[model samples]
Target: MPLQKSPTGTWLPARVPQSTITLAILLVLCSMVQSTTGGYDGSMLNGLNILPPYTDYFNLNAATTGLNTASVFIGGFFGPMAAGVMADKFGRRIAIFWGCIITIVGVILQTAAQNIAMFVVARVFIGFGTAVDGIAAGVYLSETFPSRWRAWGVGLFNDFYYVGALIAAGITLGTGKWQSTWAWRAPSLFQGIFSIMCIMILPFVPESPRWLIHEGYYEEARTVVAQTNADGNPSDPVVLTVYKEILDTLEWEKKEGRTMSPKEIIKTPVARKRLLIGMSAGPFSCVVGNIIASYYLTYELDTAGVTDSTDQLKANVVLNVWCLGCALAGTHLVANWGRKGTALLSQTLLVICLFIIGGLSKKYADNPNAASNSLIYGNVAVMFLFQGFYSIAWTPLLYLYPPEVMNYSIRANGLAFSQFMLNALAVLLVFVEPIGIVNIGWKMYMVNASWDIIIIVLIAVYWVETKGRTLEEIDAIFEGQKHSTVPDVEAVRKGEATVNLAELEKEVAATALIVEK
Candidate 1:
């Protein structure tokens, strides 16, 4: 349906089909599995010997613990690259199905781990499985949903990752008192539950209609499109219009003989912009110092004199709750404000919080008196704000913006390349974060503060607006072709005048246009 303006002044679809909601939820669950595993690892830091559940369990020091944490990123680095090929060649359904299966095995090994080596290996498997899910779910959602529902679909998928994070924190808090290995191991086992849920849902999910069209499966694509429409009517103009757009785009690609392989995608300037945007997301979010706060919160808090494990768990839960809440808020913000606006606003808030957090933290570290307790409290509050603001944009946009901007032909490959860059940096930061915490302390926040400004400038200058536009229309924008605005998707569905792309292009080309980066 077309977008309706709310009293609050946000544009949203008038009605969304049951099929779209179901598919988005399933994808969100798939994405959640990976984030749950990440959350488990992050929360696990709380149970280490230094804190309350100080079971002296996993009696490891900073360097070793960091290595174990980095193992996930190591697996993540390779998994997406492999999944990209699998998703492109084998189809999104099969790729996510196997990814879930792999995750199940990883969770088992992690839960039953007899030693650090075994646990690390299991973590790698979990990372690999989730990375595969990331690529498949992202590409599939972007391809399946209509333009009106696209932003919300991607936003929910991004939001659920943090939902998994909150679940992990809650699990840790609940299990902290357990005296046995089960304390930490139970949370690891919970990681597989999301993957299991995804596997169950996959049987009911359809393959991407666009992928079907790209492979010349016209009948299959058309049927899927029809089923995806609000009334499930095959002859619905909404269905036919989208089908035609896909066909026209594919025909153009075939006529031009434009190769869309990973190498070729990079070689094309416009396609490469999609990859760069995707790749940039990871560094922007991770480098802003959230990674350190996420994985090593217990350590960070401990250094600030909040050394109790139970207290650390409480703080972690509160922080995660705030992050998750902001992520929920982001789903609307992204749709209302557009990606570029939301990102700019979010980054600005993040920079402000980081400076306050950094300055206060430095004071608390330099002087640990009761007077500095206020500094500690203030820093903690701002840290929560930092996470909240980060979630408002960076959380969803990191994954959402990339696929929206990517060409359908190479969507999976582009997403994989982005994931690779993200994890590559993750590996470095995950390992170095612990060391940096020990050596440099609160000054580390300053580093993130500095990067946030650069990231903001880059986004303002380079990010394109994708709000209220169809995937096909987005292609025209990046290709520098003039395409008339599609004011309302519901209008096209009703066989309105907006359905004709050729006429629309002619009209658009005749008028003076303004494009924003």
Candidate 2:
């Protein structure tokens, strides 16, 4: 069966159904729930520190405040490992359900906390619970979206993370009205609203068709693939073709006896390459210094003499909106530049921006007079630009790349491990930022700037392009087969090449024969 040529004379897959797009939106929203809250929760202390009324209520200084923020990443360090098991064993939907429940509990704890200890503990709970939502949503989107739209869909999913950040910033500005604990407590309670929305929607969405096929639920998987087809016709060639591909890919994995354990992932060649590529993104993203920068934005700006609390919160709103816009632009950019290309370009820009920010900050550290005004303004402009570059490369691809690279056998586990590595580094950076600020001041920017230089080199060498390919097709790229970096949607739609199961099965068998010889 072949794709029918439309009136426009362009070959394309059947129009993906509105239902599928709706599902994708829900999944993206699911991702945003935790991220928005995580953004709001993680940075709440930062906003509070600058607001004297709230700071007086909590009696938080730089050291104790850093500890509270560090506690979230501490739980985040372990959350993904636990969530991975749940996702692989129970299903993506169930993992997300449990994650939301735990997050709501964590939110409740934070909202009602009588002391700093209770609030710190609550951060850990939010970290642990929300980590699963982030990991599961990425894996779910990767496994389900059609090949042509996969990168764009995943980009949308990741882009919403800034939506969460924007929301958090808005909440900060809104809540700044009250001089009481409600200023912070209201936002802490607000995080639950998104979680509750997710919990309500989870029951309605279909499970990942790939997971169903992997689990031998062929009938269910077929139905899902059919239902999500643009035309919503199960008999559509595109639907049958995708269903067959899923079946064949699962059979091939079974024949190979591939291990799914995170512990085993590092030992397999293709799997190890995937893991490294995915895992490196976490540290590289951290080394770029966005997480630390976001958490301490208020402090950094305040130190620069943006002393008014409302004014500091307003600055964050503007910065987050700028990042959100960049993320929107990146979704379209990936089609032309490819994942690795976009990342290289983004990282190179980040390195230069960081140098400007660090150099200018260091140049003006001892002097706050009018003579240093240009340096201060330059530092601020570069800092905003820093998020712009990161949004282009890291923001959209952060969720897309890891899952796209991993084989289905270890997809959940691999992503979980990636998140684990991310939070582990985050734990250190989150803890280190305040201490570094107190002791070394603006020089901390120079340390990250140097780290970004190394990240640029690493990405140039190791990263592979997964754009314009299906999940199963990406396997061959890592297996040392020659895969095109060229975008292939036009070819697939024109029937020049189809990602059919029969073709992929034959390819797998041929590879096995070569290995045996």
Candidate 3:
């Protein structure tokens, strides 16, 4: 079956499972705070030059400090893969509940570390624990939200990380303990708190209706859908049709047309292409520029020939703050423009900044310390611009893309797989990042700049726009039609499929061409 769409101008009650929504929020919060637990690890690598208060604490070395930051990604790599399988086999709630347990153990290990090796190992465990939130949260929201509100629900997820950063910043700043490794430990303890809260209340939250049906529990499925729908203002037609559609969309498949196996998922043209598209998104969403930007403070500017510590520190601080400006711009433009267009514009800006900065580093390498800071601040200022463009275009919205490309039956698994690859890629980059700084000099930044340029070109060439679109409409768009019945407004009106007929027909015509080929 291709897809069935309701006529335009239809809206019904929005479905946001209250329990799932709350659990998703808490899960995201855990991730936000847990990530910042290693804030000082990056700065610690370079601190080998001067012994801090506990300079001999475990006889720390640059290699171990680097391991500390990189371990999170490494542990995170396998963690999500494991969690994804559990979610499919068990339940999202259970996956998250156990994730907290892992995190608590990791944090306790960090706090009690008597040696460098112990610290690194502990960080790995913590990474494993944190990874579950990414998969569980994404699926939880996707399952709980109606098709119309799914994007909005997921996009809001990243905002919590920003909030988490603020909280961490305040905590570390307040105690004046950022100088100590224990400053970071405080954040991890909070994860335990959050996990316990979610677990205590999870029993009250209903299971996903779709998942329930998939498991042959029709009574539970209907009960959940009806309850969730009753909480909202449902259109008469939507009230009549929503459950019917939900049941039809999610029926357990015994064969190809009815349901698909994981192997067929990778082999079928439509399914394979979607997975690949999601794979591309997984890397781009987190890698290249964003990763580099996140670790800006870790690298030493003095070796690049900046002699003055104050100036280098100021430059670094300014660069990170500038990212907020870029993120703000991204928040505004992401919805208005298509995903491809937003990504193109932002990436192009990043490329420009990289070239300018790379040239300035070369030009000023001899100066050591420039008294007049024009180019230093100006191009550095654009770094934020680079961030702004990325935030609006790609940073906040990529999670929304994976679910749209896949159909109802496999959207959860597709996102879980993409996240699995994403965490693995992040781990690889984190491990590689330390080597790049140690061996490359100014070349590390230059390499990322080059990567961003290539990313822009690839995005412009192959990436598709997915804003304000429906699942059926998206499937239609990928099929190659010129138009689709995707909606443009923020909120949907009751009973409306809200797609463009011309676009849908055009895309259908194009999809036919792909098959003909």
Per-candidate total of colliding backbone pairs: 1, 3, 29
Say which prediction, candidate 2 or candidate 3, comes out ahead on lDDT: 2
Candidate-wise lDDT, in order? 0.71, 0.72, 0.53
RMSD of each: 7.4, 6.4, 8.6
Tens-digit per-residue lDDT, 1-517, candidate 2: 1222111111111222246566556556655555565656645655665666666766877777777778888778889989878887777777877888888898899889888899878888888988888788778878877777778777787677777778878887888888788888887788788778877765545678877766655556666676555544655556656665566566666667775666767767777788888777766776687865578887677445455767788878888889989988887787657889889989888878877777676666667565366666677788889988899878888778888888887888888888898899888888788778768877877888888888888888888888777777776787654232222433555578656556554553444343233
Ranking by lDDT: 2, 1, 3
**TM-scores of the models, in the order given:** 0.88, 0.89, 0.76
Top candidate, metric lDDT: 2
lDDT digits (tens) for residues 1-517 of candidate 1: 3321111111111122245455455545555555455555565554443343333456677877887778888888889879888887777777877888888898899888877788789888888988887778888777777777778777777677666777777888888888777777787777788788777666555677777766655666666666555435555556666666666666556555555577756776776777787567766777777886778887678556787768878888788778888997987888888999999999999889888877777777777765466666777788778888888997778668878787776678888888888888999998997898889887788887898799899999988888877677677668886233444455585555555556544432332121100
Better of 1 and 2 by TM-score: 2
Ten contiguous residues with the weakest lDDT in model 2: 4-13
Backbone clashes in model 2, listed as residue pairs: 15-230, 16-230, 17-230
